[model samples]
Target chain A: DVKVTQSSRYLVKRTGEKVFLECVQDMDHENMFWYRQDPGLGLRLIYFSYDVKMKEKGDIPEGYSVSREKKERFSLILESASTNQTSMYLCASSLGSNTGELFFGEGSRLTVL
Target chain B: AQTVTQSQPEMSVQEAETVTLSCTYDTSESNYYLFWYKQPPSRQMILVIRQEAYKQQNATENRFSVNFQKAAKSFSLKISDSQLGDTAMYFCAFGPSYQKVTFGTGTKLQVIP
Candidate 1:
């Protein structure tokens, strides 16, 4: 079976702390994405990488950045975590250009105090 | 730019009954894909159904099916014989073969006993 694994399932960080969320997909999908999920607001795209070292800002990318050093690994970085930034972080990967389907990891819940 | 909308934020259905979640989207591209994703509580998010833009027939998976209307740009999901295990947040997503996918706010469905 295909799998998308997240490094942390839950994390608690202080305000202004540097945070890192790592995701790795064994499916060898070319496109990887980072999204922040919040109540009522649903999932908002933060960043996505179509190829290694190629990243694009999604609708809500202001406070986050991403790195794709390898085809299977994509990382999300929060330069300065804030209280407002606390939310469930989801990592997803798709096989092709179309959203044929997105295989998602079991999400990392980040709590910024 | 592509946008997806899920007007119903919350819905409930009795066990063994049926319910539908509505989704609408706006996109200029004629060729794209629509998808329904399910995220159960603290569980991995997975694809429930998907429909190609060019196909006239809707997609289905067991008891889960989609109602795809191309001209109206509306794609809805129907759950038949609802079960408690079906309680989850459902998201509608849209994108073309070469573009980033857009997601809606999502609908939280509760299957009552």
Candidate 2:
């Protein structure tokens, strides 16, 4: 089975602090995605990388950015953490574009106070 | 742009019974993919089932099946013999390709023991 691991399952940060949520996948998938899930709004894409060092902005990438230094690891960075940034962040990876199914991590719940 | 919609915000089912969750999507393309993902209390998102647009036959995995209506643009998930472990937040997603996936608002399901 494929395994996707997030560095932290829960995190707390103060306002104006920078936050990092890390995800690593063992399947060596070529595509990785970051999303924030909020009640009533569902899961909105933040950023996605088709390959190492490649990234694309999704519907709601305003307050977030991503880094993919290696093919197996994808990291989401919040320049300045705000209360509004508190939500569940999910990471997923797939073998290729549209052909393979996604394998997701347990998710990171970040709380900004 | 493609969008997925799950009108049902919450649902309940008694153990050993059957329940269906509704999902609808809008897309301009003729070929794409649809998926049903379940997130349990542990927050790990699991792929419950999937269906391809090119295939007319509905996809089924064990007791989980999908009712895919191309003309109506509807994709509903049916769970038979509901168990306590079946309780989770179910999300419907759509994507033209694997680059990005757009998810619905999600439906919270509670399986009664």
Candidate 3:
């Protein structure tokens, strides 16, 4: 079974603090994504990486950034955490093929106070 | 820009019955893919089923099947013999080849005994 592992299951951070949410996939996929899930709003993409050291901003990339230093790992960063940035963060990886299906990690729920 | 819409915010079904969750999307691309993803209470989002735009036959997986209407731009998920495990948030998603997947505001389904 392919596995996408998120470093934290739940996190609490203070306002203006720098935060990091880490994700690693064992499937050796080329496409990795970070999304924030909120009630009623659904899951909005923050950023995605198609290759090592390559990243692209998604629709809701205003308050977030991403890093893809290596092939198997992708990281999401909040430069200055705010209460509104608190949400369930999901990590996913895909093979980057025509019929690629995203394999997701167990989300990390962050609460910014 | 492609947009996915799930009209029903919530639905309930009795155990061993069937329930269908509706989804609509707007896109100009002819080659694309549609998917149904389940996010359980554990917060692990998994792909339930997927269908390619070029395929006329609907996709199915065990108790889950899809009603794909190309002309109407609709893709609905039908869950048969619903079980307690089926209670979760179901998200409808559209993905164009080599593009970010767009997700709908998920529908929360609860299975009653």
Candidate maximizing DockQ: 2
- List runs of model 2 lying over 4 Å from the truth: A97-100
> All candidates: CA RMSD in angstroms?
1.3, 1.0, 0.9
Clashing pairs in 3: none
Candidate 2 backbone collisions, by pair: A98-B98
Off by over 4 Å in 3: none
Tens-place lDDT per residue, model 1, B51-112, is 98999988899999999999999999999999999999999999786337788999999999
lDDT of 1: 0.91
Q: Rank the candidates by DockQ, best first.
A: 2, 3, 1
Q: Is the docking of candidate 2 incorrect, acceptable, medium or high quality?
A: medium
Best model per lDDT: 3
Model 2 lDDT vs. the true structure? 0.93
The Cα local distance difference test for each model comes to: 0.91, 0.93, 0.95
Interface RMSD for each predicted structure: 1.9, 1.6, 1.4
Quote the lDDT for B6 in model 3.
100
lDDT of 1 by residue, A1-113 (tens): 99999999999999999999999999889899998998877788899998999998999999888999999999999999999998999999987554568889999999999
Q: DockQ for each candidate?
A: 0.64, 0.74, 0.70
